[model samples]
Every structure is written in structure tokens, then in C-alpha cells.
Target: MGRRTPKKKSREIYNAWNQTCWIKGVTVNPMVTLEYNEWWSRRVNDNISRPNLEEARSIEEYLRVVPSELEIIKQDFKKKTSELEKKIEQLEEENVYLKLDVDL
Candidate 1:
């Protein structure tokens, strides 16, 4: 096909975009409707840079989440608390042994 001008290309996009909004008896000017104008503006300005297909990941990979800082800190806290509790138990046992040694 011949190269389509930017205005023609946008008009085609607008026509395809609004194809479903047709009414049997009523003709609507897409430019006149507030919804269409808003949609057009968004469509024009919504160009976001995205990774090409080669760099794209699977859905699961995209959806996967790394542990947040709070979660990591909570896990570390739990580990430290458990270690301290074990050390406290060992210290209590040592104290009991010392008491027995003194009482002997």
C-alpha cells in the first residue's frame, strides 16, 4: 500500500477506534463528543517506551515480586530473635550448673 499521511493514519485509527459506538439512526461526530476527544488526546499522548518482544519476559516472570524491605527485615528479625532465645536458654542452663556447683 502507498504510504499513508499522518493525518489519514490518525483518522483511520479514530474510525477503527470508534467503530463500535455506531448507532442505527443517529450519526455522531467523534470530534464533537467529550468522550472521543478525551480518548483521542490520551491515544495521542499515551506513547510509552516498552521492551521489544525479544526483551519481553513471560507473564509469570513479569508478575513475580521480590521481597519488600519490610518483609526482609521481618525475616531477619525473626531469625535474630530465635538465635537470641537459644542463647538465653544456653545461658540459663549455665547458670543452673553454676548454682549446683556452689551448692555442692
Candidate 2:
């Protein structure tokens, strides 16, 4: 009988470790996911093995910009809501005046 090679033993150990990891509900780290996605995108874009620092920097900038943009949108919504409420109140007062005129 032939003996298993060290590479085969290592493969078996790796498989066992993966199985145990799944059974224990161990998850892939979010940083690992982000790194892997960035690496994969870089590979697809330039056929390169390393992440693109420029692209990563741009993504960081976009993340920073998003909150300020969201704040502007929220403020606009609040202003519109207040304007609508004032219009509603004015219409209600007019309605009450019309009802009194009709009753008289």
C-alpha cells in the first residue's frame, strides 16, 4: 500500500478545519470580505494581483460624502413637511370659516 503524501495530509487537515469551522458557525470576517472584494475587482480591472489604492481612496471619499448628502435630503424633506403642515392648517381655518358662513 502506498502512503499518503504530506500535501494530501495537509489537504485533509484543511478540509477538517473547514468542516469544524462551519459546524461551530464561524463566519468569514467582514474585513476579509471587503479585502477579497477589493482584490477581486482590482484583478478584474487590470489583471493585477494587488488592490488599487486609488480606487479604494475614491470609495472612502464616496462613503464620506454620502452622509452629508443624506443630511441635505433629510433637511429638505423636513422643510417640505413643515410647509405642507402650514398649508393644511390654513385650509382647515378656511374650511371652518366657510362652515360658519353656511350656518348663518
Candidate 3:
């Protein structure tokens, strides 16, 4: 493997933070975001001082800012759908958008 340049490393850290830490549709608290980013910076940066330290530090800013987005989504889904909702009259409907929130 080849060594990554400083700018490349910075961009990679920034991209990783954005992709992994962002929870959509929620207002993140500033203090919490700061703490989260600090933790992530320590983990990824490992005390290595560099020109693009800001991007690496930014990765930890996400800390489930909405409490529990998944739980809320699940509860809402269950409230809206019932046992009778499982039935579909059109057999072909099964072939389209088939997804199992089910696991075996």
C-alpha cells in the first residue's frame, strides 16, 4: 500500500465523519457535537499533528443526537401498520419493492 498525502488524509477523515456521523432530520447539540468530534479526533489522529487536523477532529461530532431515531421509526411504523395490513389482494404486488424488515 502507498502512503497517503496530507491533503488526502484530511479529506478521507472529513468524508468518513460526514458519512458515518450525520443523522438526518435532527438538530444536533453543539456541545455534544464538539465532544463527539474530540473523541473521534483522538482515535483517528492518535496525536499526529498535521495541516488538516480540523477534518480529522470533525469525525466524532456525531453522537446519536436524536436520542434514538431507529426506535422512533419502529414505533411509528408499528402504529401505522397492523396484522390485517399484511394481506395483499394483488399477487403481483409481492414482486415489486419486496423487502423484509423481517429476518430469519
Candidate 4:
């Protein structure tokens, strides 16, 4: 008979769930964020000094910057949506004039 694998401890499962919640909410503490940023900077600086580097370092940097990048994207999306709404309103006004011209 094959032996059964052991199940994960309840504490480990709870910690994993808690980490998921924190990540989903982007709820990292400011001090933790600063420390992570510093660690990333040091890693990037060290990679720059290397003779040849893989694409992984760039990917790592992207991961490090993702939260700020996501905020910029969100702002840009709102700006674009506002501009689109204005354009849509203008088009509706133009359509009304075209309908009046047809009716006449």
C-alpha cells in the first residue's frame, strides 16, 4: 500500500489565507514597502554590475514597480473614459441635428 502524504498544518493554511487577503487588498505596511523597495534597488544595482544578465532581473523590477504602475494605469483609464464620455455626448448632439435635418 502507498503511504499517504501529510496534510498541511492549520496554522500554515491560516497564514496563507491571511497573506492572500493582504495581497488582494494591497495592504502592505509603508515600512515593509520601503524595505522591499530598497531590497529591489540593491538587487538591480548588483545586476547592472554584472557582465551579462538574463531577462529575469527586468521581470523582477517590473514586479517591484507593479503597484505604482497599476495606480498610473487606473488614473489613465479614468482620464480616457472621461474623454470618451465627452465625445459620446457630442456625437449624440450631432445625431439629434442630423435627425432634425432628415425630418425637415
Worst 10-residue lDDT window, candidate 2: 23-32
Candidate 1: tens digits of C-alpha lDDT, residues 5-47: 9999999989976775655224556337788789888888777
Tens-digit per-residue lDDT, 15-100, candidate 2: 99999888666555533677788988887988656776766666566777455888899999999999999999999999999999
Best candidate, lDDT-wise?
Answer: 1
Candidate 4: tens digits of C-alpha lDDT, residues 10-98: 66787999999998677555446777889989999988865555544675676774458888999999999999999999999999999
lDDT of 1: 0.86
TM-score of each: 0.42, 0.36, 0.21, 0.36
Give candidate 2 regions above 4 Å deviation: 1-67
The regions of model 4 sitting more than 4 angstroms off are: 1-67
Error of 1 at 87 (Å): 0.2
Candidate that scores best on TM-score: 1
Tens digits of per-residue lDDT, candidate 3, 1-104, equal: 98999999999999988866675324465446777888988988887867775555453565435648888999888866753365543444664535442331
Error of 3 at 49 (Å): 40
